[model samples]
Target: QNTTSFGLTPCPKWNPNGTTIAGNSSGLKGNDTSSLDRPIGIFVDVSDNNALYVADHENSRLMKFNRSQHQDQGEAIVPSGIISAESVFLDREKSIYVAGGGKVMKVIVSGVGETILDGETEGEIGFHELSMTLYGIVVDSNDSLYISDGSYHRVVKWEKNSTNGTLIAGVTGEYGDDSTHLDFPHGIYVDFDYDALYVADINNNRIQRFHPIGNLTGETVAGGNGHGNGLGQF
Candidate 1:
């Protein structure tokens, strides 16, 4: 079920109709020299959408691949900064932000090295009591970050250059179907135009929206009936 394809308009020799050029029905690791295991996160380069970055989770590395070429697998970049990255977001400045291990880091691609959240010693507060698992991250127009704290069942927001984060939605230690609660929340998005935040309330099988200014509580926008592979159900 995992394969790589190309555009039909290109009309390459190997695949005239643009079918899968890599991976196979056998489900085997396509390449011996370079392969992926538990590829968890993918992000298209901000400068070029054709270039991709994959968080090779199990392999403990990040990869870069150019879609137009036949590079069976990606080239590993920033091999040591992350232990297990759950999400990646590229800002307008082309800096990469990674979320994992209850810490969000900034990795500058231009050899500036990695910078983690500053603690009190650096003259700012930090995440002393962060959730066990972190997933999904999005940076808003103002360079603020919103992260989905999976283990704690809540969404947290960290402002630009701020050491600590504020709970934007859901109550910590509480998980339920109620408007103010979240269960296994993942993949958060911020609509700057509306000043609203949307969360994929995974375990609750619904999507919820919270307004930062007026309402910190989330209201279900989709799914609530139950967990099922039916219409309107996540």
Candidate 2:
């Protein structure tokens, strides 16, 4: 149940003159050559903000936008090969990482798509052998991806071209209100300059940080005394 409506509307300053762009009042979902449905992930091209890439999840495609030319709509870069795309990350080489459907896919700027990790295998580029709720991916400067798993309550780090990931944070199969555990971790960020990872522990009502490296040992940097509006709360 999506209580509220969803649509891709232009930001205020982007088009100050208020010209029409992609999408309509009706949240219609469709593939390339049509409107988007349940679009989730979006990334602005580093060199060109007008050129935005979107993970058209339900459409199983990636859409690219040229604000100057395609303000009315975006064009599909990869016409197929994506599933339930939840998040998208741009690498240094301009490739995109799509996270969803129990797999992490790499979409080259040239529109080639390949699977980097899935839940089944064990040898390399495989998630742990268990049901995984993958979300919140952050790519480090070295092209390493740090992903969070809400189902297993842990974070895994997969190096570029690696066969498997190293569990870096959280306790597997455990959820608690302590520094050693995380409850429904969401939204991860990596600070390459400082060598730290930050996680939003949603259910725990706090944010945690793993410094130097993700060693599963986290320190509460904010919100510990439960959700609230006062200082040092929520």
Candidate 3:
């Protein structure tokens, strides 16, 4: 059986901070325009003990919850400002970053959502594809974003304060052949310690990695062909 609860700190909410789990207990109601029915996840605000934020993707909004304060204090930080968000990241300064619609956008705590990076959104970059859809997004300590262009079969880096993106992975025009190129790149995670990147190459049914500076790339740290519903098994 599946059991869940919304509270200051609850089970299966992933990580628990000093206080609340950071979720909205208010169920859907009549005339509720915002898409609160499907909440993705709750993000904690490190600045304040009681402050927590939830990504209401369908509603295209981000709202904050403060445990010390009553439900009345709940407020939408960025309202109706996102479209089909797949992943979200919160920086140390409480800045919320969202990746969707083949682009990554930033919403400062002041409530302004601006298209920060996108090859198709801004001027054409090194390789622009109107069909490329972005999956996972992550920002390095340098504030540069790493994204997977699924349609192009590779990954690229969108440096901070630059409209142009340099190709970090070869657009080999194939998916999961295990050759000298990538296939259907999906999710990406930056390994700061080793200056490397891990990617979920979906179509290839595996995960791969590349050095931060490139030229030193490798194959799935865990070997599998995308058979299991969870992590790959040897």
lDDT of 2 by residue, 25-119 (tens): 36565664547777766766646654677777777776777875656567766666655566677777777787766677787868788877776
TM-score of each: 0.78, 0.74, 0.66
* Candidate 3: pairs in clash: 8-20, 8-21, 176-204
Poorest 10 consecutive residues by lDDT, candidate 1: 118-127
Q: How well is each residue in 119-202 modelled by candidate 3, as lDDT tens digits? A: 554543345432336666666767877677777777777778976666776453445455447776767777767767787776
lDDT by residue (153-183, candidate 1, tens digit) is 8887777877677888877657888889999
Scored against the true structure, residue 174 in model 2 reaches a CA lDDT of: 78
Candidate 2 wrongly placed segments (more than 4 Å)? 1-34, 68-70, 121-132, 228-234
- Misplaced by over 4 Å in model 3 are 1-58, 62-75, 121-132, 170-173, 229-234
Considering TM-score, where higher is better, how would the candidates rank from best to worst?
A: 1, 2, 3
* lDDT (CA) per prediction: 0.68, 0.70, 0.61
In candidate 1, which residue pairs clash?
none
Model 2 vs. true fold: TM: 0.74
Give the 10-residue window scoring lowest on summed lDDT in candidate 3: 28-37
Clashing pairs in 2: 29-37, 124-163, 125-163
